[model samples]
Structure formats: structure tokens, C-alpha cells
Target: MLINPTIEQHDEKRRDKMSQVSLTKGYWFFFEHEGNDISMFGSVWNGKENVSFNNEIVSSFRNLNKFKSEHSFSKNGHNYKVCTHMTNMLRGTLVVSLYCDDELLQTETLSQIGKDKPSKRFFSKTFLWFLVFGFAVGMLAGYFNLFG
Candidate 1:
């Protein structure tokens, strides 16, 4: 899936960094079937360790040439065939465009935030504290002034 750059950039960075240490280097494996046979073997290169096929998003990029010769899928009406499992794998195409305030999430999730600073961080810690206290006291005074 194409992740939102503003949100998923960190994840992408992590994946790219960890992919370099493949002891054997990131390489491709090929296989073929009857009309369109296919095979793919690679560990999911997340930020951490190389995850297994179950976790990786295998696609044509893993090996495009071998891919076109293996798997077969019907498109429009034609039964176009592919040679590798990667050929049939789902691909993630990230399309980043300008988003307006209306397009953003209404809820506040931790992933959407940068650092864990509170809402009041922009203001001085001491002044903000006094403002809160003053607001509380003023409310109480107004209540007593009205009821009493």
C-alpha cells in the first residue's frame, strides 16, 4: 500500500536502511509454471530484521523479467500471462498530492504527531500554568459571586 508521506516516511526510511545488510545482498529468485508459472523468495525488509514472505510485499520489481513469464491473470478480456509469482503480486503506488484541511484526519492519532509535546508547549510553561490557575479561580469567583 502507498503510505502517506507525511505519516509513513519514517516507516519507508526504516525499511530502506535495513535492506542493505542482506549478508547475501538483496537478489532475485525465479520460477515458472505451465502456461504462466511463478516463484518469489525474499524476506520482508522492515526497519528491523528481514521479515519473511508472509510479511513482505512482493511484486514485479523483485524481478520483472522473470515475473512476466510466470503468472497469468485476465485483464479487460485478454488472459495475459505472467511468468513469476511477483508478477501477480499487488504493488503499492504512492501518489502524494496537496491535501486541504478537509482531507486530513479529524481524530488525533499519535502517528500523526511529530514529537510528544503537549498542546501548551508553544507557550511558556510557567505562564501557562498561571493562566490555568487564574481561569479556574475566576470561574469559582464568578460562581460564588452569582450564587452567594
Candidate 2:
């Protein structure tokens, strides 16, 4: 779904304010085209926003994986590229770089505040095992009732 530019701008500003207030680590990369700031992950970047583009570009954007390490696209007579580099996996250090027409536009290094907790993974595995055990016991009970 396409998002309105005004609403997108508002959300970006709000997120910026919240991050500043809480000192959280977050980053945004955007490009300016025709007096509008289009966020990289927003509707415009995904070719959802209305523009005079043929089907091929739109399809390319639609099929593109935003999480990939590198991407390059051209829209509205401008070339854009996004590159994500993993500096440290354990520390969650990421370097996001943006380039316009072969010129570097912006680069940001972002890191998570704390280490990831494994409790959620552990809980999910345990729950799956519990369900399997319960199902096995239920099947055994049904067999005994039918054959005994």
C-alpha cells in the first residue's frame, strides 16, 4: 500500500523525536525528488507512489529485496543505490550507505543498544516439543481405548 508523503514525513519526525528522547538507536535513509523526500523503505521507494514510470521499473522495485546487502535502481532520471555492510554481527553494527548517480549521498553507522536474548527461541522450541509429546500421548490413549 502506498503511504502519503505528509504522513510519512510526520512519522519520520515522530520517530526521530522518540529516538532522541529515549536515546534509542535507529536510522533512516531517504532521497529527495521533485521537492518530495521519499524514504527508502516507504511507499515511494517500493514504487508504490505514483510516478511516470514504465512497468519494468515498478516490477523491478516490487521484486527487489530491501534487506539485501546491495541494490541499485534508477527512477525519474536519477540513479540510486543502497548498500548495507555488516560491521559486527554480535554487536549488531551496520553501515548503511546511499548513493545517487554514483555519488555518495549519505552513510550511517547504526548499532543496537544491547545483545539479543535467546529466551524467545528457547521458549518456542520447548513449546513445540511439549505439543509433540502431548500429541503422542493422546494418540497412545486413543489406540489403547480402541484395541484393549
Candidate 3:
């Protein structure tokens, strides 16, 4: 869905619990645009979708990737929105940020955080530690002649 480009939701029902996540993961912005001026911002990003409006989609070249897009529209008023999305494909976690003239308007992060790299990092670290500990134990046993 083309969510709001900014945080000012005309309806309260549209508000989300992202006042905190936005600080670390995402941001939104809104601004006024007028006549022939190259607006600084207003964007959107959709990774799964190919047809993005008023912007481009950029990939991070990794499964743990980010998507970026942006554009603006206005003849004499604030009439545009832009957003970016960083999503972890392995786990369904999403981070989206929107902007206008460098001003933040709204941000949203999927509450269901995706799986972190715990599996890879955890297993690797544990295995390495185990190997080190085993080596030390074997050396001690050898010195004490306990394994003979």
C-alpha cells in the first residue's frame, strides 16, 4: 500500500506505535513545493513491487537488504511524499522511512521483528569457543597424564 508520505494522518486510526523505532530505524518528512523548484525530498520504496511511483527502487545486493525511492509533486503547495524501506528478506522485518525537504513526517517498522543473524553468529561463536575450550582441556589432561 502507498502509505502516507508523512506522519500527519487525517485519521487517528492510521497512527501507529512507531515514535521510537523511527529514531533508530526510520523517519518521515513533509514539505511545501512550488513552481519549477527542485524539491529536496518526498519519496517511497517498495521492494516486492516493481512499479513504484515518483521514485526509484534501490537494492542493497543482499538478502538483508534495503529499498529506496523518492519523488515530489507541486505547483504551489506541499504535494508530494517519498519513502524508503529496509527489509530483511530472511525474516519478515521491515523498516520504512519517509521524507520531505529533509523534514520527518512519519516512520514505521514492522512490530514483528525478523530473525536476526543469531543462527549464523551464535552457532559460529559457540563452535569456536567450544573448540578453544576443548583444546585447553586436552592440554591440561595431557600435562596431568589423565587421558592415558
Candidate 4:
């Protein structure tokens, strides 16, 4: 007797939860291509990227401080490429694209904007300090007649 396994379908809500995690630990991307399970992991902190086909890692590499990185691999005479890009720095948005045989198959984006509150407050506070410091410096310069 043989048992058949069912494939699990991913929804948009799961993707949203994954995006929030991407900014901290790393990113996990899952896709299905021609009945093949394709998964990828990328770490922004360590600059490591890995691509897996059917639970087997096909390509792995490290690229640091890059706005965009691309990894390519071939399996069973077919070529595959995974491209990761930092679309927005402020929002910490990461866009991952998968291609097979030079054709785009799927694209996913991970973003941590309003989801992370501490970092958001930090930016606002920093900007306020910058404005206050600039105003103080300008007043000091005027009082000393430094413009002349």
C-alpha cells in the first residue's frame, strides 16, 4: 500500500507574518515551480543567501553590504536564479524574485515599517534632536556675529 502526501498551500496572511520576521533573523521564501518545492533563505545581518530545491540546498553564497544580490543554480538541466533586493532602506523592505530558465516565476516582498515600533520612535526622536541642535547652532552663530 502506498500513501500520497498532500501539498500545503500558502496564503497572503502567512506571507505578511514572514515579512515581519525577515528584518530581524533572516528571510524565508517558499514557492512552487512545476511541482517542485523551492525555498530560499537570506540573512541581512550576516549577508548569507541559500537556495534550496525540494529541501536540498542547490546554491549558497555570501554577499555583504549589497543593495541587490543574485544567486543562480541549475537542477535537472534547468536553470534557476534567485534575486534579492533592498527596495526601501527606510522601511527595511526586501524583495525576492525567483526565475527558472530566464523566466520570472514568483516574487515576494518582506517589509518591517510600522510593525517595528522601537526603531520607528528612535528615528523620530533623532530627527527632533537634529532640529533642536541646528537651531541652537544658528542662534549661537548669529549672536557671535560669525556670519561676517
Candidate 5:
């Protein structure tokens, strides 16, 4: 299986940084099957997903609302499918699999936990808390004004 360096090694600290940078552009998966070069790109923020063979795009679509999506194409009289599954919401983890003729060939996973700072996460939680608090207070004030 042809694998990109960024997608192969997941435990190392340096690879974590590389993954963060790649997220800005999107997640890229490279594979080789039966003498064919296949590449897949999945966006993290948006819902865009694409598949290419020999540098030519074969299938592309946007997936929103659903946690799992699949892309299918045929080469050499065989059907090939690429599936992306979101496994973890908190960690932002996704599992991608490649299948040939309904048989699984390879699998890869991408996560956004690497290089994530605690401060950034804390601020996000704090912001969410304030948003909820403000909403509750607004509701209470409106209720009192109408009742009084």
C-alpha cells in the first residue's frame, strides 16, 4: 500500500505538528493499488471530499450532516470505494478505509489532537460557558419584565 508519511506515523511528536499544518489545506491520503496511483482529500472544516486516480479526479462530493461518507469508483473492471468515518467527536478523529470489490484493502486515521494547546481548549470551554450563561440570563430578564 502506498502511504503518505504524514498519515503513516501517528504517535510521534513531530508528525503531530505536520498533521496540524496539513489540516489547514485538508487531509490527504495517498495509496497505490494494482499499479494505480490513488489520492483522497477530505476537508476538516468544510464538507468537501474528493478522490483522484493517477492525478485525475474521478469522484468528488460534499458531505454534511452525516458522520460517515463513502466515495466509489471503478478501475480495471473492479469497483473501488473509499469510506470516511468519524469515530471520535471530542478528539476530531476520522477513520478512512479503502475497499476493492467490496473487500477491504487499507485503512488510515487522522486526528487533530496533536499540537493542541490546553489554553486554546480552555478558552473555547470558557466561551461556551459564557454563551450559555448569557442566554439563560437574557431569558430570565425577559420573563421578569413581562410578568412584573
Candidate 6:
């Protein structure tokens, strides 16, 4: 099975930091069945390095073949909804939706990676070069205005 999962940050402050660092803030796991991705819904960090999965989800995956339903779980004040739908009798897909308080944060589609993949790093080399060029241009403009 091929699994592709995406994450969306909710908090403004944390989002800003993630944009600058591109580091994984939490851990996630999913099960693949016949090339279909079945993502677990209720795993969260307990302020430690290890992630904690809800007991219900664990049991459901144990009997995954018989599991055909939707589940909801809450962690760190965030609510999540997860479900799987069969495209055919033999293959299906899973969807995980996340919300903060009452506002929708992000919805991840777990599937195979695409050709236009995003850079893992937050800041690219080209972005750094652009920053340097902008700084140089600003300094030159200020000098011309003040001393020319």
C-alpha cells in the first residue's frame, strides 16, 4: 500500500516558526491496504518525543478489514475526523480532517507523492540569495539618497 499524508499548521505563532524551520512538530502513522492509505486519526504528542495513539483507533486497525466507519478524536484542543471510503470493493482511500477550536485548520489527503513535491526545507537557497540582494539594494539606495 502507498500512503501519502500532509499536515497543516493552525496556530499563527507555530505556523510562523514552522515556515522558518520546516521541522516536524509531531509524529504520525498510517496503515496501507492493497495500495490504499488508511491513516490513524487520534495520535498526539504528550509533550514528549513519543506519540500517543488513542486506544479505539489502535483496536480498529487491528480489525481493519472489518472496520468501515468514521471516528472522531480530540487532542491538544484540536478536533479530528477520520474515515475511509471504498472506491471499489477491493481498494479505498482515507481522509483526515483537522480543526482548531471550531475553525477548520487543514485536511490531509494521504496518497502517493506527486511530481511537484514541495521542498522539505523551509528556506531555499534561492530565497537566501534574494534576501541578500534585497539588503544590498536597500543599502545602496539609502546611501544614494543621503550622500548623493
Best by lDDT: 4
Query: Residue 101 of model 2: what lDDT?
Result: 88
Candidate 5 accuracy as lDDT? 0.71
Model 2 lDDT, residue 13, Cα: 55
RMSD of model 5 against the true structure? 8.9
Residues 2-76, model 1: lDDT tens digits? 221222332534433321212123322322223222222332232111111222222333333332222233423
Residues 22-131, model 4: lDDT tens digits = 34456777777887777777775677877777657777788787889888989878899989898897876788999999999899886655454567664676578679
List residue ranges in candidate 2 displaced over 4 A. 1-34, 41-68, 114-148
Q: What is the TM-score of each candidate against the true structure?
A: 0.17, 0.44, 0.30, 0.62, 0.63, 0.26
List, residue by residue over 1-148, the lDDT tens digit for candidate 3. Answer: 4432433334343223322222123322222223121212112222232222222222222222335544443323444454445455333344545444566655556422325334566456556867998999999999999969
Tens-place lDDT per residue, model 5, 81-123, is 9898989866667788889999999888876554554546645
Off by over 4 Å in 6: 1-68, 88-92, 111-148
Overall lDDT per candidate, in order of appearance:
0.29, 0.46, 0.38, 0.72, 0.71, 0.36
Candidate 3 lDDT (Cα, whole model)?
0.38
Candidate 5 lDDT score at position 123: 51
Arrange candidates, best lDDT first. Answer: 4, 5, 2, 3, 6, 1
| Candidate RMSDs in order | 21.0, 9.8, 14.9, 11.5, 8.9, 17.6
* Of candidates 4 and 1, the better by lDDT: 4
Candidate 2: C-alpha lDDT: 0.46
For model 1, the superposed segments whose C-alpha errors exceed 4 Å read 1-123, 146-148
In model 2, what are the clashing residue pairs, if there are any?
A: none
Q: Between 3 and 5, whose lDDT is larger?
A: 5
Model 4 stretches astray by more than 4 angstroms:
1-20, 114-148
